[model samples]
Target: MVNGTNTSGFGYDSSTHSVIAEPAVWDSYIQVHKEAGKWRNKIFPHYEDLCIIFGKDRAQGNKAKDFAQMEEDANNEEQSEQIEGGFEEQTTENEDSPNIGSKKRKKVDDVIKGITIAANLL
Candidate 1:
């Protein structure tokens, strides 16, 4: 919110002389201008160039999206690195594993006394 107003949504588009209601329309207008070879900024372009692209209401929505994507990408990269490091650390930690519960049961056989280790454990 800038100037106590959320400047992101439908706004007036004087470039085509109409109110741009959706982001898709604004993006198309920019693409059209770029294909026409006249996409540019004239010094203080806040009221001139950007107004044509986003209109009066959506001043920073596109920029905000770009920044958000950049932040997400950075986070993903960091997470990828962390996962790779985890694998490396896991291999070393497995050497001192606390898996004593999975150890094989000791062998015992005493048919006369009726004491025997179950075959299922083998």
Candidate 2:
């Protein structure tokens, strides 16, 4: 009872009386669905409404924390650069000064003593 050359299990194109492959049927279905409306056209308004209702506080808090952390990191980096520059200047000056070795040894001893005191306090 079937038409000519339509023995394939895929969709039958009645006009052409030929069997459409599964992939072709799916492609045509998707094409028709897309022509009806875009996927986002159905969901964008709901997404926007949800963001407006729920995103404000969480977004602002995260942004504030991130900005603060960035500023703190920048300040720490700047201070470290200044400290390194100061040490370089000190070494250059100390090269011309008398008792350069003694001066550096005394500074090292002072730092060690400060660390010892801090350890004792802890």
Candidate 3:
């Protein structure tokens, strides 16, 4: 019954032997692990969100896969260009236009496709 720093049965018993924990010490451990479980969820929907936004038909196209690949390729190309040229190049079609953030800028995927089409023309 002693709950202070030390005393009888709780700490030193009548024989002064330190008894270990008893069996069935915790009868309810599961409830502690589930605390705030529902509050923890992904901040952003997986690639599926992008697919829906792009209006892709699940039965026909895998847009999430395509986008992941495209983004990977664009990143690799950028790194290679930076190393070969000492720095990556930036092109602006109009100087007087308003400055926009990076995401607002035209994607390099479109630029690459345009270059591919122009190369076939020549």
Candidate 4:
């Protein structure tokens, strides 16, 4: 015989000094635990793949090699754009200014020559 006030057959029991567990609460907890376990299992493989791809240095996350490759790609793209005449020639109206146009043209030519050499290397 429980000695506390019972509300709809579930309430705090003074004799047991503990709150009765509702069935729905236990069911929800179980469902959440199961879902968490399922997701962990599903994601573990991808995590392992990343570890393999990144190698032992995965923990540091430095990715220096990747960053260097990206920088090289960007430089190559910029060189290509320059070769394609992507930059506009800036002309100064002052006659006293040295031949800026010739200098700029020479710079573009040098970049073109460098890219040509690199292409020949490949």
Alpha-carbon RMSD to native, per candidate: 20.4, 21.3, 20.9, 18.7
Off by over 4 Å in 4: 1-87, 90-98
User: How many angstroms is residue 118 displaced in model 4 relative to the true structure, after the best TM-score fit?
Assistant: 1.4
Which sections of candidate 3 miss by over 4 Å?
Answer: 1-52, 56-67, 87-122
The per-model lDDT (C-alpha) reads 0.47, 0.54, 0.42, 0.53
- Cα lDDT over the full model 2: 0.54
Candidate 4 local lDDT, 68-98, one digit each (tens): 5766887788778765653344434144345
Q: Model 3, 7-100: lDDT tens per residue? A: 3322223333322222232223224645533323213224334546655343345544664576678668876864553322224323334443
TM-score of each: 0.26, 0.26, 0.21, 0.26
lDDT per residue, candidate 2, 9-46, as tens digits?
34434455443455554466557676632331132325
Instruction: For model 4, give the 10-residue run with minimal summed lDDT.
Output: 36-45
Model 2's TM-score against the true structure = 0.26
In candidate 1, what are the lDDT values of residues 9-66, reduced to their tens digit? 5454556544444556556665766652233221232645554576656536545556
Candidate 2 worst ten-residue window by lDDT: 36-45
lDDT of 3: 0.42
